[model samples]
Target: MPAATRERAIEAAVELLGAQGVRALSHARVDARAGLPPGSSSNWFRTRRALLGGIVDWIAEKERADFDPAAMPVITHLDELIEGLCAMVELQSGPYAARTRARYALFVELAGDAELGEPLRRQRREFERWTERIVTAVGITDPVPATRAVMALADGLLLHRLTVDPDLEVRPTIERAIRALARS
Candidate 1:
């Protein structure tokens, strides 16, 4: 099969994982969901681990695709960073909800597999580095820990939005926390 076939499979796999959690994922299910010939996913991935790895890469790519490091300088004010982060939270919980759900599923599902988790770890480290750079540019003294804490806060809020209350008005909270982090 070609790259499109692989992409379709990954996309369909994310849809499946999002709609029904990990139990819904299978080669045949992915093929049917993608409208590809039977065995297409297995043909490309060859193993369950390989399939999960592909899924991680796809989700990570989708997550990072919209972010541009050059945009960091544009956030000359704390309000700008707050707005950007709030927008990100909105996107993750709204338009990209399914992919976000699938990404979370994979995070928990493969939490114990060090080898398989490397891709996830790599994605997270890159995100943190970028966040640290943005924080450093904003003159945050403790960019390292501040970046980690901010990321953790975002993740927690995303989880809460997805799980507890989908209607959470996150802007005020995000603004307060970001401003406090920026100050500290």
Candidate 2:
């Protein structure tokens, strides 16, 4: 499928899924949300599972772009990482915020389902790779604990933002964690 069409389908699906849960994201609904024809979603996405798989990939790609580790300054990688994380939390107010929240929700909900497990596994693996890269860049000799710390912090912050409140600040918390990690 063409990149544009696939991206549109995934975007629409995410929005619809976010607003109404995964059960409401029918092919026709996705097409309507995406402003495409009735069969466009079905033509582009064969099934809801396929559309969700595309969403997983799309979320990974967008997160990677938004948190571009290479774009950070070489010296203050910790600060840069913190800034990237803060920016992500702040993205809760952006145009795609609903999609972001829905994607995570779907990820957790479908994690145990056999049909979506593979895609979730791939998504998590990709996230781990990114986490490992940040750890390595910060010169953390033992990446095992460092990666775990990053994941834990990220997950906590994400949950806090999504569940507790949107205005919740995570920068200080993330910075404190980074400081502790540095001292370790």
Candidate 3:
């Protein structure tokens, strides 16, 4: 199959997963969603697991597509961290909403399938490690736990925006969390 078709299928799968849920994902569904003929997705992925794995890989690539590894940004101060995290929350819940939602859907649906979900798990760990560097530099007392707390809070806020309140103001909430942490 052509790479464009393959990518289209993966993109469609992500949309299906995001718009509906995990149970909505299938080769045929992706094909239909992509406006490709029957068997188009199967021609590339061949299995639901393959498509899902492909989706994870695609998401990881898109997430870090323009990220520069050597140019690690410095979150030198609490206010800087607050602003940076708020921007991240906006990007994750705004332009990347569908993909982010698809990623979270996969995380929940495939939590028990370590074999199939390893890529997603690995991506998360890698994100945490990257987050650790920023938090550590910012002088968070225990960077590891702080990373977890920040990630969890951000994710919760994202979920709330995605699921319940599309107009939720995330910056204040993030600022509050960071301020409370700073006071500790």
Candidate 1: list runs displaced more than 4 Å. 71-73
- For residues 64-91, write the lDDT of model 3, one tens digit per residue: 6644445546668888888888888888
* Winner on lDDT (1 vs 2): 1
Ranking of models by lDDT:
3, 1, 2
lDDT of each: 0.85, 0.74, 0.85
lDDT of 2 by residue, 1-184 (tens): 5778766877888888877877787899988998987888788678877777677767766766765657644433778777866765677445557766777768776777766656556666777887777777776667778888888787777767766776777888988887778768
Instruction: Give candidate 1's error at residue 135 in angstroms.
Output: 1.6
In the order shown, the candidates' Cα RMSDs to the true structure are: 1.8, 3.0, 1.5
Instruction: Output the lDDT of residue 164, model 2.
Output: 71
CA displacement after TM-score superposition, residue 121 of candidate 2 (Å): 2.9
Per-residue lDDT for 89 in model 2?
A: 62
Output the TM-score of candidate 3: 0.93
Better of 1 and 3 by TM-score: 3
lDDT of 1 by residue, 56-103 (tens): 988887767766566544665677778888988888888888898998
User: How many backbone clashes does every candidate have?
Assistant: 0, 0, 0
Off by over 4 Å in 3: 66-72
